[model samples]
Target chain A: MSVKLTDDVGAALVAAIVARSPYRRALTPMIGEITRIALANNQIRAALADVAIRSNFEATRTLGRRDLGPQRATLMSFLEYVYFASPAFLASVGEGPKEGSHNGH
Target chain B: MAIEADHCDVAIVGTGAGGGIIAHRLAKAGLKVVSLEQGGRLPDDYFSETAPPGAKLDFGIGPSTVWPADPHDSLFVHPLFADGAHGATPRPADGFRHFQILKLNGLQNLWNGVSVRFCEADFAGWPFGYDHLADDYSQVERLITVCGTKEGIAELPDGEFIPPKPLRPADTMIVNAVKSLREPFSHAIPNRKAIITTPGLANSCISTGICTSGCPVGAVYKFSARLLPEIAGLDNYELRTNAKVTRVLREPGAETVSGVEYIDTKTGERRRLEARFVVLAAGAIETPRILFNSADDADPAGLANRTDRVGQGLQDNPKSVLSTSLLKLWGHKRTYDIGYGDLLILMSRGKLPDGSDFPFIGHAIHGLPDVPHYLSGFAGFPPAVKIRMARMMFHSYVTLGLFCAGEARPENRIRPGSTTDSDGVPQVTIDFTTPPAAREQMASMLKWGRKILRKASATKIYESIDNNGTGIHYAGTTAISDDPSAGVVDRDLRCHGLDNLYVCDGGVIPNLPDKHLTLSIMALSNRLGRHLEERVQSETKVAA
Candidate 1:
């Protein structure tokens, strides 16, 4: 089924996923904007749907989790989309002490 | 109509790895040099780290706004692969799709800068061996400012290098683990990369872990960033961007190439530039395509294809990726400074058909920013569970990339298609298949890689074998050989039948070693420059 990700739905998905992340404060504000831009690519959109279906299969068989169905896939797909597309989110979570200078140079 | 001839000594096509070095060397030696680059110069902020919201990002490097929307749009020759299951239907794969980068600096701008020299064994079938090009290799090393530790491994030779960047904790663990293994499998060394590590020469690598998207600070070696500035001020050197060379122009009834015909990409105007000599460094695929496209009634096959070997013997390193999670580093805080380039070189010795020791090389990469994407794909968990798993396992991720030496076979070749692109250049049809022996070697390498990772306390190992063309280190299209029947070029890189046509790109490489091919291409170009300089001086003396 074709799921149109409007700004409100994308924002809701972003809010839900960021709530579970450690960098919730940093990612919550910017992730929706990033996701909206990424979803513009038809290739990425198709890939998201493919990943969602495969994720559902893995969850049901391997993890023994109840099939949360399309809603669950939608939420997981949005999370996957943001994870791959949003470098800002990656940078926020990966922030750490920069090595002052490499090899004492 | 053809434009008026401009005075030029040497006209080089493609301002990439080979062309860039050749232009710099020839220009510095006081010879007039002109380089034609298909793509124009990128903007100053092309590699900037910040992007406006709603901009597309690639691998944590900011907005890819400067890059073409489709990577194939930059290529002069688009490659069609015959990789269908039945092996008859030709289609595009991830490998050839991203193979050629047509920007001013070419693929060098997007390279991860893993600069390792081919070992002595790698020169088995070449007209010249390692010792012949040793000085050239050292010169290119110093020019590019390669960073590594000289471990004196015979299979993986050491080069002139700055101090290597320190290995991260995960890399250190893997290195120590390899130390406990048996001979041949036990050796691991810091990767020798072309990235600048010295403080004063240029901006040093800040370990942003985004080298592939173009180094924002110019720490990584790029022709436009490093060598172009050196030659831009020379009065004898000229670089014409947005000039797409169509073919090498042969002088009537002569065995020498006189000049080149190109299209002004900005205006769609056909132009000709005459020169004393012409060098084709457009790349392995496009170089041969240009030669084939230049075929006429005199040389119906191609200019240098008298032996029908211009596009034969094409090869690319067959690669496999093994991803694993370091059990020891799980739940550790993630750091962005983990080197995006190969952190360490893992060499395993194997036996060739002649019972000679062949070095099988693999690179260990740690803390890639894209780890979470891989995790989210296969984890099969709920959204919250997947997020938590990504957070916890982020620091534990380690990917081992293995590249086997590709054997140059006559069957695996590139031929010009009947149709042409919008610019009137022929599309390329690549008929490449992984040889059975190479496939066996890749399988063996993958198995051995899993063992090494297991030794390093890695869990949940996964292997992904890439399609043949993905290695991107294309070579041996126009191979070098002493016998005219066997190869396209001579030891001096001059085409066997053509007096003034030279090939200084990866096309002249006789074989593909496991290591990256850029540095070797640069070294060959440097050697060619010195040879041409001496020849030009001798000719001038005879004329005087």
Candidate 2:
């Protein structure tokens, strides 16, 4: 089964992931791939997401204040990073550049 | 993939001092001119006379600021300056938005409003000297609304100007020291600088001490808003923003550039433009990058890189700061102590063992602006302590000794690298270093500054000093020569191997002598504009 992803779904999934685990460098690629596969596979998408959310929620309860500040900035940074890094944004913008940006250096 | 060429009599790149001066001159001469600027045009309201709270990102903090370049490529960015080698891909700056070739985040970087002219001996190695460029310099000075005075020094050129802004008490003390040291055996003059009170921003009119953050009032000349207005009404001129030239297209069987290909920065569209003559005022780094990227498949070494000098011999004016001791002033507190003063000018006085006298550039002892006051106030200093600090500052002086915004040997140089962006345009490798002589001069100047201040009877003096900020002047690499085997462009500024192409920016100064680079750059652009006019007129006659 294939599951279709929407903007809200992507945002919620990212938020849920952050709400669960603090920034583990290892988690980025894992979440990215899992999200991609979930979007591709319809049948297990919602179920897997629900399970991931439950586990992530449990994980968040164990995180302390010491990890919050950087985690938030990093998450904000990651969201911004993801937005620009999205294939959709890149596709619409294409690879061609605008003027006043060339430096050759 | 759509490529269309728009033709013109002359096409100039960039729109700062170099491009703006050239446009004004060429358009005045009745030639149709096209100026391609990568940055978007700012409306009349773009500049705020009020103080800006933070860094303004035209592109992005760095390479990230520019759209369409590889998001990964942050080596080259606008408002260029010296940081590390532009060739070195830097790790992301913490919390900073992006990376760039040069780091110019500071308000006191680059020329920093120093507009002194090149000295004669300083021009010995240059193709022409003050006499050659005098008339043109005057013309450009008028166009830019320069403020300066004639010092009658051989190494320094004088120009038309407003009345000299008098030095503050602190600056006066140091100036007295340098002058007092003069005698038949000594005869040394304090170095000179051009400092003006910007009238644009506020009623600080008594002495609009703001110079670095850009004159809130248009007292000092900034190219975009100040000088361009003089040439705004010319119908023959067209300024195109966001048109980034990717490559220069040459004639099928000739070295002549027929036109250029560019990317539309906003729409991300590819396009082309044609011109009979092209003046590249895209500044030191970008100018050469354009040449490097213009290398056609048939000519891989690059269009103007035959000598490989297209990206060699890069140099920034080497500089060091000298500070004086602080003196206690016994007087009522006044706002004058915390004001910026005029940049004084003088010549080099030392004779080399070989009988050659190196030009000694002079900077006025600038008074401390109100920054410390605000900082101290913020830190909760008592009013009495703040007044005492201001009083001591009133007697302090800092004469920036001239060690040659001096030229450096090209061996201490940077290069253009091969990492092309998504557009296939290569990147620049900007590397530079300070010479031993420059360093020694810095030490000596600091010692001298202290003595000078001591002469004013200072009770205390800070031992530590500033380095006049990182040497921001960038040049060389694509120097002008008649032969393709020597420099990138010919003496006419035409690319040696490619006709109809020219670079008229600071990058052509093979070795920048100790002088403010902007004034010379403006003069050179004026010269290029005149040369272009002559070329176009001759071509029209030939056609007739």
> What DockQ do you compute for every candidate structure?
0.13, 0.02
Task: For candidate 2, write residues B1-544 as lDDT tens digits.
Answer: 1122288788887776678778777777888787787656533332231221012211022222322223112213333332333222222243112122221111122124666677676565565666888887777666655555555655566776654554455556555656676633222332232333343443222233334433333444555545456655666767777777777788544778877787876788988888887777777767777776777666676677766777677665444344443444444233342333444553334443445444445565453322221121212454346444544443243434444555546565445564654444556555545556656555554555455556766554444322322354667767866556767776677777677788888778877776668888888888887787777778889999
Among these predictions, the greatest DockQ belongs to 1
lDDT of 1 at B528: 94
DockQ computed for model 1 against the true two-chain complex using alpha carbons: 0.13
What TM-score goes with each of the models?
0.84, 0.68
Model 1 regions lying over 4 Å from their true place: A1-28, A44-75, A83-105, B1-5, B49-98, B200-202, B334-337, B350-357
Q: State candidate 2's DockQ.
A: 0.02
Best by TM-score: 1
Question: Model 2 — TM-score against the truth?
Answer: 0.68
| TM-score (0 to 1) of chain B for each candidate | 0.90, 0.79
Off by over 4 Å in 2: A1-105, B1-5, B42-111, B183-206, B251-253, B323-325, B330-332, B335-340, B346-357, B365-368, B373-405, B418-425, B457-469
